[model samples]
Target chain A: MMTVIYIVYSAVCFAVAAALLVVALHRACKARIAARSERLLAQRYVRMITALLISDEGAPMSRFAFCGRRGAKSVLARALASVSRSTCGDGCGVVRRIMAANGVEGWLLGRARRSRGYGRARYLSMLASLPVSVSTANFVGRYAGSRNRHIRFWAMMVRVVADPAAALYVLSTYPHRFTAYETAAITAVLRRGLLPLACYPLLTSPSHNLKALGLNIVRMFGMADAERFLMDIISDDADRDDVREAIFAVAAMHLPVTRGEIVARVRGMSLSERRSLCRRLACEGYSASVIMRLAANRDRHYMETLVASYKRSLVCCG
Target chain B: MRQVLIVGDSGVPRDMVAAAAECAGCAVVCVDDMAQAAADCKRGRFDRVVVIGSAPFFDGRMSVGQLRPCGLQRPELYVIGWHQSEHTVLGLLEFGVNQYIAFPVNLRRLCRKIGAPIFRGI
Candidate 1:
């Protein structure tokens, strides 16, 4: 009985080892095949892009025969998107023409519709990179309120690109508060001339996040015209974050903020807020006297120490 | 042909910039590391050093004083930034960068800046 049990145990162990080996081999083979295909795809992309770059405007569209290959649309889309992103002016027009000719938009829309989860989001992101078309916008709008936050974000992005004129409206109504990453992404899209010709709408929006974004835009573009609006936010907006953003924008743009306004704002702010404001103003090259003037009697000693320390740090860094 | 050195991490933008430069009749060399790029500039006579991407600049790695230590031959420095702010532009100018090119990169303008004729065609 003992001999029989030992034999069975050995047999079981052998079978398990054999299965493990088979799985390992299968994975290895699969990885090798995938790598080979990726290499081939990369080579094709290089060839296609090189040809497109060197080809003349009058070059026959038929010469890009690879566009018609099965399973090449996604690869082609990626390559074209890369080209389009790295270029502006006439180069953008050239890429758009190629995408249109190959029915890339329709193909992408179909894939987006059929996909779910991350796959759907991926397609929407790709679509966002392309020029906004009425059809693409209409399709993407359906997913704007998707249950998945990821999908909803990408859908909102597409909407922003499709009609930048309504960017403030779309952003203001965003169901969730904008994360930093989302805000940056949206700001990048807006920079692409998708809309919001003026940031006045953003400043006027009820959403604090949108208002902050508007302040950021003003600072970024050096929009002198928005100074009045920024001052309004500074004086009236109760949201600390929005107020901080407005203050930073004002400091960055070197807008005139009266000493009385500074003293009043500083009086209401906590010690940390005062410190941050002082640092920002200092960094923006505000005169020592001007920054000192911001300190209320209660915070004079603290403000003096802060200014001295900041100056020392600057010297050390330099 | 003009020799151009592109300093940036490997990305679509850097690759496209290299391709555009090559198309415009320049021999392009791309280096991912700022140190390696500085070394290459010392080793080769690059007509222009196009620094693509903002990481090196914003991360406080590449600076005007740092570039001097590399002994570069005073090649025109161009920084291609994605959505650069006024502060960033001023900083780049202070760092002795010849120009600040914003994204999406205008390939034609880039070609012109490098003193190369714009390559016509798609």
Candidate 2:
């Protein structure tokens, strides 16, 4: 009787193991099929984009049956999210950035938000994956203000390139902490376009973090075109010193300013004031234009720093 | 209106497109593959052909490579590779398709895709 009991127990164990193995195989098969579907979808996405990019003759292909694809759609959403993040930083791209910033981006981001189904998890993952900022500015700008976090992140990232003020505005109001991952998102925006940080059209931001962050961003801009915008916005108070410093910084970078104009403006200032102005420009990575003026005898204090700044500029630009 | 021959793979979004075409007053015939699609083309049953599928189907009604050489009686061909194999779909274009739509199709949008091209051809 004992042997009989032992045999029954052994039989049950074998059956349980077989059942578990079958379940495992089933899951593996489902996963593989899902993966292949994802690959196929991504291929379609690139093709469509390429076609859109190249063709003016044909109507855009718009018949996308993006419904009921719990598995495949989720995977596709994740893929799109990854592309956005790779292009921007977070999975968000232009449309989402704009939506968050401004509508087209909003709708898509909304879709990403509202998605549910077997595959919705994948969409969520992609939505969270923003691209690096430095690289993806222009791409996002094309569809700028995309509110979908992933797409908007890309667009905002691109804007950060040329105009960090806008990017910083997005970040400070970002509703979430900027993670290490988000640095790329920020850089992507900057790489696309550098907004004159000192002279953006921002109206009323509530957070000091936003203000301080905005100021820092205004300072980081390449200062190549800051001259025009700065001249326009050099008044009013928040940080007039920072703005003047920035102006001097731009001049010192040697961007293209009449020294007669700068000297004429500063003729009444003390020697220390003139030296500080030169140092500000030297530190801000201006071109040699400002240095030519400083190379004159009376303003000779910054001569050494200007030479080092010029060397550093060459190293940085090259 | 121009006619379109639609081939329905087992799992694609053919039904939606076909219904859309039919609703748009397009003379569309539904078939399963080259044999039937070709026959219909020969019989003056269709002016163009559209192939669509839903799930990943094995039945080979219209592989992109096979599209050009088949010498269908139809003047234009469109393939909707609902499953998203870009290489396969792009290959179809090389084979001389008017266009390829990704599926699960937005029927309303698809009607416009085929309709505009057909109208322009006229």
Candidate 3:
């Protein structure tokens, strides 16, 4: 019993010693972290001071950037990155400043897209911080359809950062696989301002994603011509749900001709088909009374799905 | 005398699948949607099934709502479509799908890709 107690005491002492050692090590780690952080901050402060002292040598961008200019930090950073690359410094460093002032967005974009080397990647990263201009936007466009996936993704990001209009041109031209990503970017561009009609064709493309995206653009822009095309496609297909989507598009348009056409078409359907068509027409804000009468007897194959969709629409919406 | 069933929606890729099947001199039964395709899959006396469509060739709006028919008695199935479904294909593959081909389907590449494995176990 005495021996066991002695062993237990020793084990407890060792555990306590280990705990104390861990606490000491933790304190040492914290001190190291603080010192490292202080050194990094001092280095940044020194760089800032040096940059300011050199600002008077005709360095508007680097000066403005050093002085913490708003709305152009990204641009200046881009310029600095570009001039730093491409043939070293020359002409009293004024040439270097001019290059910095000259849209780093373009330079980095150029390197990222066209150049292949370690230096180009550094330039690309520097340009990444700036708001891209038109030329930079155009440069980023080169990678929108890149065979390299990473290059394509970065190019797309640069499009959003650069001139958003140029980004639309890229999204409109990018492969079908990237449609969802393209739509999100293009929608942001549209939110900023209207996209051109040339972009309309891509919306209703055969690709499902593009078509869905097109439907959104059509909804947003209220383009009647696009709606007409939707109507034509819907009318040609015998598919009931597609036809419903078409009806919804027409109803969204709220055109007098479409309303009259819907009534006429609804009047022509057999009572069985009309049961389903009536609900769609009603959901489009026509009278639901006609649909309720026909719903007394609807097709068994469709009754569950259609009625559930119809009831859900009423439940959630109304 | 084993056969394959193909579900083709409107467009170029579908046509390409048809042409390749013809070139191989294998009989293929084609349909427009999953409902008809699934029905045919069960009834057609086939050894394999292939569905070729764009990203959502089998959207609920486009076909019967089922991913794989509960009563399917057909052969092994292969899908060459725009993509694997969000998560549905794993279950479908578990059910019986032999393969799932995601697109940007290059016909030449697909033919080359499948040239070996398709004929395996034959």
If ranked by lDDT, best first, what sequence of candidates would result? 1, 3, 2
Query: What Cα-based lDDT does every candidate model obtain?
Result: 0.72, 0.48, 0.50
Model 2 CAPRI rating: incorrect
The local distance difference test score of model 3 is: 0.50
lDDT assessment of candidate 1? 0.72
User: Interface root-mean-square deviation for each candidate?
Assistant: 3.3, 17.0, 25.0
Tens digits of per-residue lDDT, candidate 3, B1-122, equal 34556676633345445444544445656677777766675465665667774434323243322334555443556677533333445644553556777643434344433332343332
Identify the runs in model 3 with alpha carbons over 4 angstroms from their true place: A1-130, A134-172, A194-213, A221-225, A235-318, B1-122
User: Model 1, residue A79: displacement in angstroms?
Assistant: 3.8
Question: In model 2 chain A, where is the ten-residue run with the lowest total lDDT?
Answer: A86-95
Model 1: pairs clashing at backbone N, Cα or C within 3 Å: none
lDDT of each residue in B30-100, candidate 2, tens digit only: 77767666566656745567766422223334343343335443456666652233445555556566677
The per-prediction CA RMSD against the true structure, in angstroms, equals: 5.4, 17.8, 27.8
User: Which residue segments of model 1 deviate by more than 4 Å?
Assistant: A1-72, A82-87, A90-92, A163-179, A200-210, A237-241, A254-258, A266-313, B57-74, B115-122
Cα displacement (Å) at residue A70, model 1: 7.8
Per-residue CA lDDT of model 1 for A123-221, tens digit only, reads 888777777576688778899879988789988877876676776677778878777677766666666555554689789877877877787788778
DockQ scores for all predicted structures: 0.40, 0.02, 0.01
TM-score of 1: 0.77
TM-score to true structure, per model = 0.77, 0.33, 0.33
